[model samples]
Target: MTEIIDGNAVASQIRDDLTAAIETLADAGARPGLATVLMGDDPASQTYVNMKQRDCEEVGIESHHVDVDGDASPAELYDAIADLNEDPDVHGYIVQAPVPDHVDYREVIRRVDPIKDVDGFHPENVGRLVAGDARFRPCTPHGIQKLLETAGVEPEGKDVTIVGRSDIVGKPLANLLIQKAEDGNATVTVCHSRTDDLGAKTRSADIVVAAVGVPELIDGSMIGEGAVVIDVGVNRVDVSERRSEDSQTASDQSDTEKGYELVGDVEFESAKEKASAITPVPGGVGPMTRAMLLYNTVKAASLQEDVAVDLP
Candidate 1:
């Protein structure tokens, strides 16, 4: 029997653990704060910020938001980051990705105070993570690690084929997994768009993580028997095939009215058959990302306020 990796349940447990930590902070007269700064009207970015705010509310973290016009000047963006940095109320915040092409995203990240970079994209944080002395682990990859632990799939001595080399997920995750730490010690292979013979690599791994942003790119034929499949890609694929293949799934998606439905890089229907365990798209990595952001915010508060509490 194949096990379905339930990221939501694990994230809920993490949130519950954080709730106790938050109460400890409250008792010490400190409240954790997380803020998000969005520079554009991109629908996806808006949705992500909203979800983060909601997660903060759920876990007793204060939420703050900042919005800038898509055409805002780079100076305006810099000033916003500065405001958040100087604001004593905002402990940590993120500048949502896809800031207007005219603005240098890297420059914005540089301007952010490393201590308040809850998203963990700062070069300082990234370097610390790669160096195995992490201030805060990147959220999505950390969430994936949590999922693997909950599923009882230890990465130690196991081959992990991660099918994306982006700085966000692939590079950082590989660095973390290959470290000499408890969550580390895995043999990791990072594959990208230019990688040769992708299927051959995935078929040889004990764990396959697909974050390439291509829907249904890794089918059952590409996966090894009993491999653990973690699909981190969330693509909006056309629903035509799904509508005809599985009416129930198509009906449930309901977003087909917009011409596309959400999907992961791996074809779930086929991959689950071969994998000992797998994570579904929306319920899997998504919830965990939000949960981890809250976790980071709480951590930032504890460090900044000098309040000592054991984190979950």
Candidate 2:
């Protein structure tokens, strides 16, 4: 029987483990704090920020939020970042992506103090990651590593093919898996839209990570037998759209109240049949991403407050 990797269980364990570290910091009179800065009123972004705030509260991290008008000037957003940088209580913060078109997201990232950069998109952090001295690993990639560890799928000597080249997931993950650490040392192949013979590359690997934005791009045929599959894409497809036989069953389709359903880069049902272990779309990488963000916030607080706390 193939193992369905349970991300919720693993993430819950991580949250539970962090509670002690958070309490330790609290004893030192320095409770860890995290902040979210949303520039526009994007509904998805707002929902994500709200969930993050709730996670922080659950783990004893003080939560703060800053909102900028959708039409606000770039400088105004920067001012909010500047204020957060100066606030002692806010040990870490993230400026939610998809800022106004007029604002250069890169410039906004540059304006944030690297110490409080919980999202780990700053040039300095990226550089550190490439150099294998990462102070903050990007959340999704770190969560993937933790998931792999929990599933007993060691990447040390295995071949890993990551589908996608975006800086957020692909580039960083490739860099991480090839490093000299325990979670590193994997032979990594990065594929993109222009890559020739994508299936051949994926089929030859011992582990496949489908992070490309396209929904259900990789299927069972592309996955090697007994290989581990990690799906990182969460896409919403129209309920009326035709789905493959492996997509969803009639009973499972009842939850599409929003006229859409969530899917991943890999076609789950087909891929699960061939893989030794796989992560589900909604319960797999999503929770891990959020969990790692909280981990980074706690680390940021520990570094700033000089508080010694054992991190899980």
Candidate 3:
């Protein structure tokens, strides 16, 4: 039987540890605060921001929600970031991504102060990551690293194949795994849309990371026996029954209302049987992402408080 990599369980463990750490900070007159800049009414972005706020409350971290309109101008967005940058009380903050088409993401990301950049999206933070300096590691990649560590699946001296070459997950993650650190040092291979013979590379890997953003892109046939598969894609698919359900709704004008459901790049059911271990879609990487945000906030506070922390 294949072992399920329980991301929720692992994330809970990290949250618990961070909660205790927060309590310790509170005793010393230090309280960590996370400010989230949410622009637009993107339902998914709102849900993600809400989850981050809820997680902050659970860990005794203060959260401030800065709501802005989707139609807000680039200058307006930059003004908000500038305000947060000057706020000494705010330890860390993240500007929810996919800002309205009008707002430039690159410019907004550049405006955030590197120290308060919990998302690690700023160029300074990215540079620090590449330089092996511990400022703030990108949350998603850090979470993935934790998943591997908590599962006791060391990457060292192993063939680690990662699909997708995005800065957020693939590239930064590869940098971390291939670093000369204890948790990393793996032989890394990155594949993207341009890559040929994808399965040939995946089937030879001891561990496979799927982040191609397409559902069921990888099946059992593409994986090596006993390989560890980490599914990072969150694609929505509409099934027959779901389509029927959407037809009953009053505002269901779209062609497919009831059809979509979150699925990973890998075919979970079939891939599970072939792989030694696998992470499930809904419960995997998602929780870990939020947990790592809290970890980053705590670290940000520690740095501000002049307290040293050992981070991987």
Candidate 4:
């Protein structure tokens, strides 16, 4: 059996470091604050934003939550973000994802000031990321980097196959991997839905990143021997009757009643048997995502100082 890379333990270590850093900032009379604008009642988004708020408390940072209804007009949403952008107390802010269908989500991203865009959705930050400037990295991909570092699977000179091309993960990670740094300098191949014979590319990788949302997309056969697999997908799927019955803890039983549970793109049990290392879904990249979010928040706050961008 391959080693399980425990992201929760790693994220906890990061949070401890962040707590001390925030104390120093507080001593300097700069209280770092994060403002989150969440439109709609997306259960997953709400949970994610709430966890971020909880993390803020852990690190002695203040978080403001602005909840809007699903039908909130784009103008109303933009106005709220504008207000948060101007707030001196708010060092960074993120407008939660999957805004209502009628709202132009990209416009909302465009409206956020780059300096205050902790999520790195603004084009300015995105451009900076692509230019290899030390700026905010999208949280999830940054979390994956941390995982790889903590696991000692440095990407340098390795063949990394990224199985998605979204601006958030695949595209940015591709740039990050090839950057001239210790954790980077990997020869990266990005595969997507349009890529032919996907397994052929994946089976050759020293590192495999499964960010495509399809469940069990990368089986044991697709993973190269001794490869490090990062499963970034969080897909909700209907559970089997036997599996649900076996998941008998009160909380899990309740979850089964709710219709579906979370599963990653790589099937955990099978992938664990094949890869040299792998990240499990719920406990893996999820917590690290929030840790990297806090990291970005601090970086945004520090931008007011003369510290150089220390991007990896």
Candidate 4, residue 26: lDDT: 72
The residue-by-residue lDDT of candidate 4 on 1-312, one tens digit each, is 797889899999988878766766777777688988899999989988888899998888888889888886788898898898888788899898889999988899999989888888789988998788857888988899999999989899999999999988899899889999887999999999999999899999999999988987988888888999999988888755437475577777766788778888998887777799999988998888888888888877777543333322
**Cα-based TM-score, every candidate:** 0.96, 0.97, 0.93, 0.93
The Cα error of candidate 3 at residue 92, in Å, is 0.6
Candidate 2: worst 10 consecutive residues by lDDT?
Answer: 250-259
Clashing pairs in 4: none
lDDT of 3 by residue, 1-312 (tens): 888999999999898877767877777778899999999999999998999999999889999989988887888888889999998778999999989888889989999999999999899999888888858888888888888887889999999999999988999999999999987889999999999999999999999999879888999999999999999888887655444663555544342454456779999988998898899998988788889999999999888887654433
Off by over 4 Å in 1: 245-255
Query: Which pairs in model 3 have colliding backbones?
Result: 238-259, 238-260, 242-258
Give per-model CA RMSD: 1.6, 1.8, 4.0, 2.5
Q: Quick one: ranking by lDDT, best first?
A: 2, 1, 3, 4
Residue range 1-312, candidate 1, lDDT tens digits: 889888889999999999988998888888888889999899999998888888888888989999998997999989999999998788899999988899988999999999999888999999999888999999999999999999999999999999998888999999999999888899999999999999999999999999999989999999999999999999987776666645656465567667777899999999999999999987998889888898899899999989998898
TM-score winner among the candidates?
Answer: 2
Q: lDDT tens string, model 2, 53-158?
A: 9999898999999999989899899999999999999999999988989999999999989999988999999999999899899999999999999999889999
In TM-score terms, candidate 4 sits at 0.93
